[model samples]
Target: MTRSTVDKALQDDPFGNQAEVKYKKLGCGFAGLQGIYYNGTICFHRRKVIYGMPPNCTTLVKPRRTKGSRSPSWEELQVKLGNLKELVESARSIISGDMLAVPIVDLSSRIEVAKEVSACSYEARTSWGREIGWVYGSMSEDILTGQRIHAAGWKSAALNTNPPAFLGSAPTGGPTSLTQYKRWATGLFEILMSRNNPILLSICKRLQFRQCLAYLVLDVWPLRAPFELCYSLLGPYRLLANHSFLPKLAPGGTTKGCSGSSHPPPGSSHSSPCYLKTVGLSETVFEVTRKDKSSCDGNGSTDEADKGRFTFDSSPVFIPPAALAILKIVAIAVGAWRVVAGAVEDKRGGPGVGEFVCCSWLVLCFWPFVTGLVGRGSYGIPWSVKLKAGLLVAAFVNFCR
Candidate 1:
């Protein structure tokens, strides 16, 4: 997605705001790589981490711990604000070059008081108040603001930089991740369903063809719900139920099945079945990582970044994963034992290798959930969390079945 923002927006509208404004103010919501992606830099890292990466436009939120407030010294603030001014100048030069005069407002600072001669600019030139002036209400507010700016003939770009200007924590663990996904999906759905949706923008000729097409993909992101539900549910069921709705072969019977096991080696085709995953590129992709550091690393910096860096959570929600994990373990163990028993005795028949292998993968994948069930749940889940887990498990079982 396009990293977003219009331009420096404040009473200082650095570049002369005509009675009508021209050009864009880039107000990315996060504090990120300062002067990192200015001018030629953004296009340079186009291939690897930059291109496929999501737009780093959101700047309103910082990655600070929300537990307390912090006030810094005036000397510290002065030094930082000086650096910010240089970056703002660099950001302005990126678009208009040296020919255009633009004022880069420091949203976090005002130059009202007297300061060192070298760092402070003229008192009259300073812009006070917020730098990111657009409506920053909730999820869709940023996108909507960017869309309005774009419609008004303003263009935006993401600056490429290292030591990002700002950073934030991502939702971790099963419970938190699921909660975040649901909220995001809901927000995305609401945006698509609204009159201000990209489709309407294109219909009204507010967006060009390419932009409209790009936004349409973002607009339809919520539709993945059903398909994701299907995969999450039916993927395991395929192994358990021992069937799939898809045909084994093409019209001429010449085509191999998706699993490559539709027709087995000559004589074995009559009775033996082939393994589905045995021929595919796959592995146990889901593993829950947990952090259990009891104390600080003794680093002088008590920054939240360090804390977040050292800690990552395991599965937090109960029910769905626990049920699935237990089911998978039981099924796979039983199936494997049966296969082993059959191998030891000529008279015995057992579960097919394909079924056993498929179920075994589910067992490995859901093992973390089993941990959540056994250990985490024992501590006593909150009544509120239990309610949510019940609803979540019902949803999971519905999809899988």
Candidate 2:
């Protein structure tokens, strides 16, 4: 494998840190009562199933070495699995259900065979990525592929272990973390827009109805960023306008009336466009999350201190948070100034406490960005980002007026 390939593989936290606890609940949860979708990395599959065999198909498995049966010749195997001899032999064993068969132990040959089989011609005119192997409509291929398997009337199980069976490194830096989330959000958004979405799959296939809803929960998460952004801005708006958009409480009953970017999912590197664009079916580039081996070791390490610290980069993802933080800070300062100036003008006139509280709450929510504004070196938000955020804050202030 190339160094870049190894690095990419190392960075993939397929199951994530809390996957054990999370998947355990998923297994027992009502949505998973029938079956559950899981990451492709830590799962096994039936050979026939991967070879486009539907669950309803019935087939008898023959012994690997049955009486009067001659071993298939290379010519026949090649016809079935293309010209790749190694892949053909591998497929033969899998097809015979011979789990005890010894595996190819030669690392160099294994790599060579892997490359050959992965070549485009290996699956020419075949239903490999589309219908047989890992379905490839979305960036999040694992979930989509599993959804198709379940829709084909297959069920999945989640098995947990005492010490856990698998472990992988997660992104430790804020930029890498946000980039990973952006890629995921983009992929889910793509699934949501596709015909193979859980809702459609459930209606047209064997996927359970409740499972569809569960999938919807994740697929719709990225779309909520706008609503959340609007909600957060409300606090600052209220502070600036001295007006509460929320419904007022009355002693008798209550007054009814309450309602709710360069618009990227939070943490999109600055200058990057929105991930939910529907212009065309262009493939979205995947950003590998940065991982560290030292973080995985359970030893009482000193690096734990830095693990929790927020790290900054030139990515636009920090722009929203920084801008929001700046707006909140400005709102609080203005609110305080108004209160003080009003108090001086009259004995007891000032902006209401509720407005200040709301603005303060928003500040708390984005406290990290506020601190980053003044943080030193790489620990701080880049000046270019800060300048952009300041412009965004200024624009928001003008719009409020």
Candidate 3:
């Protein structure tokens, strides 16, 4: 069989978020370059590998031989496996690698054994989610589990097919998209901070150096939000107040009093408090992503009429972008008024083309929120969210004054 047919099916994820392409690129790089699996849903592993055996292991594992402890006898194995004689016999045969060698006479009995082991309590007090099977203790258990397997010196591969092996729904709108982003960010950040962190694993375990760097790229994504939020505010703050934080650029060289030493780095204090607060409060919580799976019936009426349009909710995730949009609008308006009133006497020192350009770029980044302000029905930014953003903008203006 071909690699595509033999390996786990490839996931054909629908594009929902604007940054979906970036995720795809990262996934491809991780799998192709590092021989590491990126998506949990698209990965396949040998049963022995899932049971914590390294790839090179050929013999069965032996239990620890302490003073009073020893390997379980056949009778004890029967009791621990289950009361079902068929299951006990099947387990013994499989452990000895002779299950397939014997012809299957009763298929129904095998099915019954499968059902029994599939029960919720089948893995209770066992090493299923702890040391043997899928690793637990994280929101993104799949990622952490895969990381551990790779750290154990096993390599993973990817399989691509002409037709995708699997198709998946993705979050379609702003609220769902942000919720998904939040969960992924929190989970990856947790992995970054945990003992299984790539740096520690590379040093202490067998995780490859390049693979560790690849994981770091994705794990550090959540940490960028605070920096981005701070960057967006600098443009507005410069325009509103007499004190400018960014260096004034000139044609020939740096301006007078524009030495890097004079200005305490822009947004240093502004982003630090928020960054610290976010780090302190970050928790690993799994949230279901809402997706749009609209289908057109014979009449052409669909459940989601505005499927491609950006939609809004009362989620706090929208608040920061909304407030930033409002701030940019206010700053631009005030800057234009300053130009009209001839209030900006100094072209060299005052808020000039650079600050306005930066603010305009930030406004473009928040275009979805800007457009949502005027959108109607479900596409509109909720009035409650607008009120909160307005209050934030007002507070920012007062602080600037």
- Report backbone clashes per prediction: 23, 7, 0
What are the lDDT figures for the candidates, one per model?
Answer: 0.36, 0.63, 0.64
TM-score of each: 0.43, 0.74, 0.75
Q: What ranking emerges by lDDT with the best candidate at the front? A: 3, 2, 1
TM-score of candidate 1 versus the correct structure, residues matched by position: 0.43
C-alpha RMSD between model 2 and the true structure? 7.2
Candidate 3's error at 273, in angstroms? 15
Off by over 4 Å in 3: 1-20, 63-115, 242-285, 297-305
Q: List the residue pairs that clash in candidate 2.
A: 267-317, 268-317, 269-315, 269-316, 269-317, 270-315, 270-316
Candidates 2 and 3 compared: the better one by TM-score is 3
User: Pairing residues by index, what is the TM-score of model 3?
Assistant: 0.75
By summed lDDT, the worst window of 10 consecutive residues in model 2 runs over 1-10
Model 1 Cα lDDT, one tens digit per residue, 122-157: 322322111222322224444544444444333455
How do the residues 1-401 of candidate 2 rate in per-residue lDDT, one tens digit apiece? 00000112322222233234335564456334456565536666776666545564532222335465544544555554577666666666655455445475767758877887888878875556776778887767887787787777777665645454654456655676677667777777778888888889898988888877877766776677766777778878876755555444446755432222222243334212335355554446766777644444466654544444567887778888889889988988877777676632222333455556667766765666777899987779999999999999999999888
- Give the per-residue Cα lDDT of candidate 2 at 128: 68
